[model samples]
Target: MKKLFFILLILNFAGCTSNEEVADRSQVNWQSIEKDLQSALILAEEGDTINIPGGYFKFEKSLLMDDKQNVVIAGAGMDETILSFKNQNEGAEGLKISQCKNITLVDFTVEDAAGDNIKVSDTDGITFRRLRAQWTGEVSETNGAYALYPVLCKNVLIEECIAIGSSDAGIYVGQSDSVIIRNNEAYRNVAGIESENSNFVEVYGNKAINNTGGILIFDLPGLTQYGEHIKVYDNLIQENNHRNFAPAGNIVGVVPPGTGLMILATRNVEVFNNQIIDNRTVGAAIVSYELVAAISEEEAVEADETQAGSAERINSDYELDENYNPHVGNIYFHDNNFQNSKWFATFQHDFGKLFNFKSPFNPPDIVFDGFMEAERSPAEILCIQEKQKLVFINLDAPNDLEDLNENIAPFVCD
Candidate 1:
């Protein structure tokens, strides 16, 4: 029995080494071989990395990555690799990752798509690093929905990417969890970064500037089922200057532009340590639509019309049903900096009024309390004479005055 066990252990060690060798051999150079897109697709198998060299590959239709695993499609760099789908007719997406796992798409620029720049659905463990997706043409019709969209995926990381001129959103994630979007730049789009019906999402260290809407967490009635448990922290969400870019029939109206950060019907959302500045409209707007208002009005009217001092009082009878009522619950906004906003901040409905506003945009003598005091951080003191209020912003760390001057000071219109 001891001899048999020793032989089994040796065989297992050899098998592991053989598997590692096979994995190393699977890596191939796509540029070394000359093949068309169709033949390249045929040659690509599981655990293969296709390196498209620095050139343009014109395709008639979208390149679909369907039901593959451990596949990497990379390029030399963002400036080098170009996938142009100018004549794509059917279901336009520059690259679609569907029903796959452990996929990596790095160092490429996907431009001029007939549809979305890159669309991923039902995939997991995906990383998009140092990529660029934009519309090359000034024509309004050339842009598409989302530069980088990961839907129904888990464990996604998007870093050092630039998304410009997307008709719908620069980066969009729906029905996903455990997503990290950091060190990305987005501009000239509808929503800079949008997450709908997703949970455990952290959007930090991003610059969302000159887009229509800076950053949005929304849950539309028809499209998404629920939205909860999101954190937006330390993002430079500023100057979303574009107009609404959605086509006539899309559902982007759920959260429109001129909104720096719009959280609609979402619960347990935390917004902290963000520098929201120079937006054309409201810096942060939170509201629910007509459904909640109608319900509240009906309850108020019924209470007003009831008889006085009766055993069955109308106020006691005015119980709101949780099914139809969509209320914003447990939203915590702490330790954020704000400056040069058009409307400053607007909380539309009564539900949004429940927030504890501490250390508002009042400068000169700025008060830092709550989480701001706990962290012992500096406050942003705006000393302009013309503005209505002296804006005092809270920060989690010491502000680099030089970096702030480089980015925000030059763009200050006033």
Candidate 2:
């Protein structure tokens, strides 16, 4: 009986070891794969398709492509082809494509990148379809800044993608024009599905959930372009209450947890036909750059006081760009559903503290900071179609909310 037991234990241990060996064999040799893949990309002609087979590959350096036209880099499937950069020693991205035209990247998973998972710049036409980008381990400040990053590109289409665990943004389209982001799921990041300083963007049919903030349309100062003519509709912006894990000094670090669909100092935006629910802090917020700037200044001063010369405090002479407009106008929200939990209040950031101070019992569904350009009329500046018994507030922040107005009478669109 003792001999039989010993034989059974030996068989079990061997089975476990064999499984481990099989898992190790699933990952191909990185040196050979890198040499062949890089050679193929460098020697590929126009209208070429580079196919990556089904395997887990590790890379130490970025895969780069430049000045190619009508090229397609496809993989077996998003889950079948995994590119991991956990041990990367060089470069800022897993895959970098620059100065290309009509490039398409589809059906691959890029994870644990040191910087961004995939970055494409200066391309006329770019498409990211059915791709997955994520960080494998804990969500923290060390995660990549963006999962799918496209900048200075025209005719961009990002659809059917999954982005997760980015420290900054899950899907960030910056300084681009004519963009469409649809049917994607973004979660566990600082900001999910963000468009910054981009024009003519349409964000629809996407799920933005479990991030610090969901669906941020922001136009910051000192950027080359301003966001305008934006449309956000038919999206599930819900439960984006994930703790902010962005690195220090990033603009998104100021975003309070539990925020959903925050629009900061952008104009010509239309929000309609969406389900915004269960966000704890606030449902939809329209605020100016001054709000963020003030919070950033306060944090900077606090840091300087604590660390002494580690950070610089903003002085009186500091100035924003002359062409940059700090006020938001021509904004409209309609036909959207907003809901928040009554028991929860955001206390993670300064903005949430202010919300708790003013509306302690229940946070408002929609909030406007009441910072508008003096030259623009009220009608042209803002509009909201009152549906779903929306709870609205005009913060009257210009007058320090002394005249805090909860009346939607003046804001209802005619």
**Reference-based lDDT, residue 172, model 1:** 84
Model 1 per-residue lDDT tens digits across residues 1-414: 111101011100111121001111123222212234444544567777766666545556777777777777777677656566656676678778788888898987787777888988899889999888877545252468778988889899999988877777888888888889898988777778888778888899999987767998765443334667888999998876566755433444333445578765566777878887876445665544332233345454544464221011112221243342243455556667766534322243221121113223321112111121123212221111222332322221123212211122211223
TM-score of 2: 0.88
**Alpha-carbon shift of residue 313 in model 2 (angstroms):** 14
lDDT of 2 by residue, 1-414 (tens): 111100011100111121001123233443226767776677667877888765677788898999998888887677667678888899889899999999999997788888899999999999999998988657988888899999989999999998988888989999999999999999898999899889999999999989999999988777668789999999999999999987666678777898898998899999999999988888998888786776587655554454321111232122547778778888999999898875556787766777777777787788888887888766578888846787678888888778877887777886
- Worst lDDT run of 10 residues, candidate 2, spans 3-12
Please report how far candidate 2 places residue 163 from its true position, in Å.
0.5
Compute the lDDT of residue 125 as modeled in candidate 2.
97
Note each model's CA RMSD in angstroms.
Answer: 16.4, 9.3
Clashes of each: 4, 0
The total of clashing pairs for model 2 equals: 0
